[model samples]
Target: MDINTICVHGSAHKTDYTGSVTVPIYQTATFAHLGVGQSTGYDYSRLQNPTREQLENVVAALEHGTDAIAFSTGMAAISAVMELFEAGDHIVISDDLYGGSHRLFHHISEKNGLTFTAVNTTDLLLIEKNIQPQSKAIFIETPSNPMMQITDIAEVAKIAKAHRLLLIVDNTFLSPYFQNPIDLGADIVMHSGTKYLGGHNDTLAGFAVTASNELSEKLRFIFKTVGACLSPFDSYLLIRGIKTLSIRMERQQENALKLAGWLAQHPKIKAVYYAGLPTHHGYEISKRQARGFGSMISFETDSEQTAHQVLERVKLILFAESLGGVETLITYPMLQTHADIPASEREAKGINERLLRLSVGLEASDDIIADLEQALR
Candidate 1:
């Protein structure tokens, strides 16, 4: 089946008794066993819920991995994956990281003895130079948040293999609809299903899919121990949301290309970062690696004042934090998303006060542009 067909019917397991179209949400804390030591494949909700398992099964199939695990949030999934390392272990990471990830690696994991080094992952040499003797893994976010940086997943995966390091790619920006990192030699693929996979921004969810059974077992052990798995009801919601993913993403990317082109031509705009644009450095590589350029766009204005004016005046695109919904959203990364990083560091990454990120939604392109034109005026 094609990806669109897989998105809908891939994980539809045998619905023996009910024959229901949707996977029935097994909303229960515990399931009854027929006899001593007998089980119905599910023993407890925390360990595994039927509804959540349905989601995991589908996602695993979608990502072309051995297995998948679902969590309450994307961070929880990441946190569990981090458990693969010991206290003294080190990891190489993308310099343009999401603020929450930056926070977790430093404030939470570093305090516990794990260390990380962030580098410009687009350059393979930078990654090679940064790998410490203790390095156990390389965590990456291609077309990274706010900045839209792309990394050659296959190249990074090769480096990981040479160093006996695990390669973990955050596929949140593109979702599996646009990109599948595991297919490119990555050991693991992670997603904040809260963003694209959930589609409506109504649910908070995360997932990790492992390319090998060995890694899957390790992650499953951590997942069972963490007790931060996704709820059964939310699992159902994510499943429904994924069914329309290809269509929603098609529209969203269409809007993003139009908007990015317009921004590049705008006199008030200083820079635009979008992989779809031919001017972007990673445009060709992104084309070779993924199915489409994602809907996320980041651009800079001539001044901070001008950026704020647009943010304040936009009547159609809501000034918001999260993305990947049906409605358009505009985010101020310097403040809302990347504020946790040091001021100097953010400025160096081009996430300065003049930068604004747009998450184009299902709104008509003309209406969205009209709002932006009015706001810019």
Candidate 2:
């Protein structure tokens, strides 16, 4: 079935005799049992809700995963994934990941005795070199946050298989409409449903999709145990948001490519980091593994002053944190997303004050480019 079809009808889990075209939000906290030892497939809202389950079903189908667990936020979903590793288990991760993931590993997970090594996953050799004897998994974010670095998912999956390690991919940037990491050998896929899946910037939600039933059972256990499940209303919003994901992503990518080309030619722009650009290091690899270049783009301005000026000057593009929404959002990694990392490390990764990330939206290409034009001036 086409992804667009799945996006539209995958959540059609028939729950009642209402014959409603849309999945109804099951708002109750608990279900009444017919008898002792009897069940309606759901006993409590914390464990599972019909609305959230439908949302998860759509995400799982989109990612080609056996199951997906929805959470209150992306961080909550990530936290549950981290719980899969025990104390003293080490994981090799992409160095240029979202700052919140970095904060979780450095401050929270490390304190719990889990170890991590951050390396450029694009370099397969470096990934192998950094793997410790106790390494349990490889977590990576292709088209990595802010920097837009792309790692070959198939190659990394080979490394993970050879070493008997779990492969987890953060598919937030590209979303399932553009890429399905599980099909490329990822054991699990993560999504910040608040972004592309939600389509609108109105809700907060997250998901952990498992490729295998074993992993699905494991993550689900941790999910219900942690109690960070998404609310029923938010689940409904996500479902509605996903219905338009195909169209939204298509428009967003079209605008992003136009904006990226314009930025690359601009005198004030030092460099544009977008996978769609032929000059990008991972352009070929991205083409081989994904369906689209996606809508996220990051560029470095000629100076910190120029970057600040653009952030303050943009009228159509919002100066805000978070990406993959209908509204175009420009973010400063140095202060907004990657601030948790130390200054030296952040600067080393080229996430300096001069760098700005752009989340192109469902706006006209000319209008989006014109907005940047005036801002760059």
Candidate 3:
């Protein structure tokens, strides 16, 4: 079936008993078994739930992975993935990932003896140079967060295979609709389902999907042990939101390109960082590897004052944290998304006071453009 058809009807949610088109919330914590030493596939909510499984199955199918595990939040999914490595193991990661993920590696994982080396993963050579003997995986965000830096996924996957290391791609920016990293050779694909998969920004969820059964086994063990599983209701919400993903992404991308073009031409703008723009350094790479340039765009103004003025003056576009919703959101990475990053490191990646990241929504292009125009003026 086509992807859009799968989005709405490809769910593994068939309860012939009730004949409900949607997956019903299996709210109970435990399920009654048929008999001793026998099961009906589900015994506990923590291990699995009917509703969550429906979402998981759909996600796995969408990403072309064998199995998937859903989580309470994006970080939880990543936390479970990190457990696949040992204490002394290491990994190479994108230098400009979300602040929360950076915190996970630098603070939690590093303290636990799992180390990381952050590099600009867009350059395959830089990633290759950073891989150590103990490096177990390559963890990267394509069209990386805030900066919109694009990585050549297939190239990096080759490097990972040559080194016998796992390749983990966070597909939150592109979602499964635009890019399936696994199809391009990713060992595992993760998502901050709170963003695009949830579409409405009303649910907090995460997903870790893998084509390799070995990785799936390890992740399943960690997911059950850590107990960061998504709730039945939230899983239902995600399933509902994902049904419109293809259409929503199409509209969001259209609005984003228009906004990025407008911002790039503005006199006060310093630079616009969107892979969709022909002038962007990663534009060609983005086109070669993915279906489309995603909606997330970051642009810088002449001064922090200008950024703050725009943030405060905007009436329609909300000044908020988080992205991939139906409504437009403007976030200041310096304080909002990437605040956990050190000032020196943040500025080094061009996420400075003057930088603003936009999560273009399903709003009308003219309204989104007009709001930015008046705010910038």
Identify the leading candidate in terms of lDDT.
2
Q: Which of the two, 2 or 3, has more lDDT?
A: 2
- Give one digit per residue, the lDDT tens place, for model 2 in 49-83: 98988898889889999999999999999999999
Q: What C-alpha lDDT values do all the predictions have?
A: 0.93, 0.93, 0.93
lDDT of 3 by residue, 1-377 (tens): 78898899856556436777777888889989899899988999999998899899899989999998999999999999998889899999999999999999999999989999999999899999999999999999988998988899999999999999999999999998999999989999999999999999798999999978988898998888989999999999998998999999999999999999998999999999999999999999888888999899999999989999999999999999999999999999999889989999999999899999999999899999999999988
Off by over 4 Å in 3: none
* TM, every model: 0.99, 0.99, 0.99
lDDT of 3 at 12: 50
**Candidate 1 per-residue C-alpha lDDT over 125-239 given as tens digits, one digit per residue, 9 for 90 to 100:** 9999999899999999998988999999999999999999999999999999999999999999999999999999899999999999999899888888979999999999999
Query: For each predicted model, how many residue pairs clash, with residues at least 3 apart or on different chains?
Result: 1, 0, 0
Clashing pairs in 1: 143-149
Residue 86 displacement (Å), model 1: 0.7
